[model samples]
Target: MEMKSAVAALAALAHEGRLNAFRLLVRAGRPGLPAGELARRLNVPPNTLSGNLTILSHAGLVEGRRAGKSVIYSARYGDMTRLLQFLMEDCCAGSSDICAPLRDVALACACEETEPS
Candidate 1:
């Protein structure tokens, strides 16, 4: 990702609430979660949740679709991959160990997706 795009994405996630909300959406997977459920899960006020979601969506981290009367927000995996690439683009000055933990985390996330609910 370009520097500007990476900055925007990072800035959006810099907030505690927005970071938590985005992580929750990522865990919710491609099907995503309805706004009400998301708010309830985070114990956040509806208006506050709306604001956080707005920031996340603006950063290209999340996308919302209207399902009935609710807006279901899902993580934008392509953008997420770009963010990951941007962060690790320079690695630890060529130390592969710098990315070991990240690779583990990505594997964990993938495992979660394939596991039986």
Candidate 2:
């Protein structure tokens, strides 16, 4: 990602409400959650959630699609991965030890996933 794009994504996530909503959507995975359910879960007003989702969508962090009567929002995992890669590209000035913990966490999260049986 370019610096401008990364800045936009980071700035969008800098807000508390937007960060919380994005994290929830990330956890929800590709299928995502409906707008109403997201607002209810976050205890945020519908209008507030709408604004937050708009920012996230603009930053390429999340996307929404119409399903029936509801708009379902999901995290853009590829963008997220690219953002993370950009941040870590110059991590710790070549100190592998300093970055080990991050790699460990990523691996742990990766291992947690299982294919449908």
Candidate 3:
């Protein structure tokens, strides 16, 4: 990802509500979660959750799709991977051990290919 895009994604995640919402969506996996459900789980007001989702969508961190009467939101795994790659592009100052733990955590949370948006 370009530096600008990475910055945008990072900025979007910098907020408490947005970050929590993004993580919840990530854990929800490919099936995702409806916007109403998300708000309920997060204990956030509908309008507040909508705003957070909007920022996340603009940052390419999350995507939403219409499913009948509701919108389901899912994490954009590819964009997330690219952002992680960007952050770790210059890691450990050439010391693998220093970055090994981070790699382990990332591997633990890695997902298969995501459905196209």
Candidate 4:
């Protein structure tokens, strides 16, 4: 990802509500939740969640598709992975141990993705 896109994605996730919403979508996997369901899960008003989702969408961290009356929101995994790669591109600093935790996180996420939800 470009520096500008990475910055925009980071800025969007900087907000508490937006971050929470993004995390929820990420955990939800491919079958993302609807806007109303997201608000219900987060215990926030629908409009509030909608606003946060807009920010996430603009940042390329999330995408929504119209499903009848509801818009189903899902995290853009490719974009998210690219952003992480951008942040970690210069990592390690000559210490392999320094990047071990990141590897662990990726492993955990991979495991989670494999299991049935």
- Give the top-scoring candidate (lDDT): 2
What are the clash counts of all predictions, listed in order?
Answer: 0, 0, 0, 0
> How many clashing pairs does model 3 include?
0
Candidate achieving higher lDDT, 1 or 4: 4
Report the alpha-carbon TM-score of model 2 versus the true structure: 0.92
Question: lDDT tens string, model 4, 1-117?
Answer: 899999999999999999999999998988889999899999999989989999999999999999999999988888888888899999999999999999998887742433211
Worst 10 residues of 1 by lDDT: 108-117
CA lDDT, every model vs. true structure: 0.87, 0.92, 0.91, 0.90
Query: Cα lDDT of model 2 overall?
Result: 0.92
| Residue-by-residue lDDT tens digits, candidate 1, 74-107 | 8887798888888888877778798888778877
C-alpha TM-scores of all predictions: 0.87, 0.92, 0.92, 0.92
Comparing 1 and 2 on TM-score, the stronger one = 2
Task: Report the Cα RMSD per candidate.
Answer: 4.0, 3.6, 1.7, 3.4
Alpha-carbon shift of residue 3 in model 1 (angstroms): 0.5
Best of the two (1, 2) by lDDT: 2
Q: Residues 29-62, candidate 3, lDDT per residue (tens digit)? A: 9889999999999999999999999999999999
lDDT value, residue 44 of candidate 2: 98
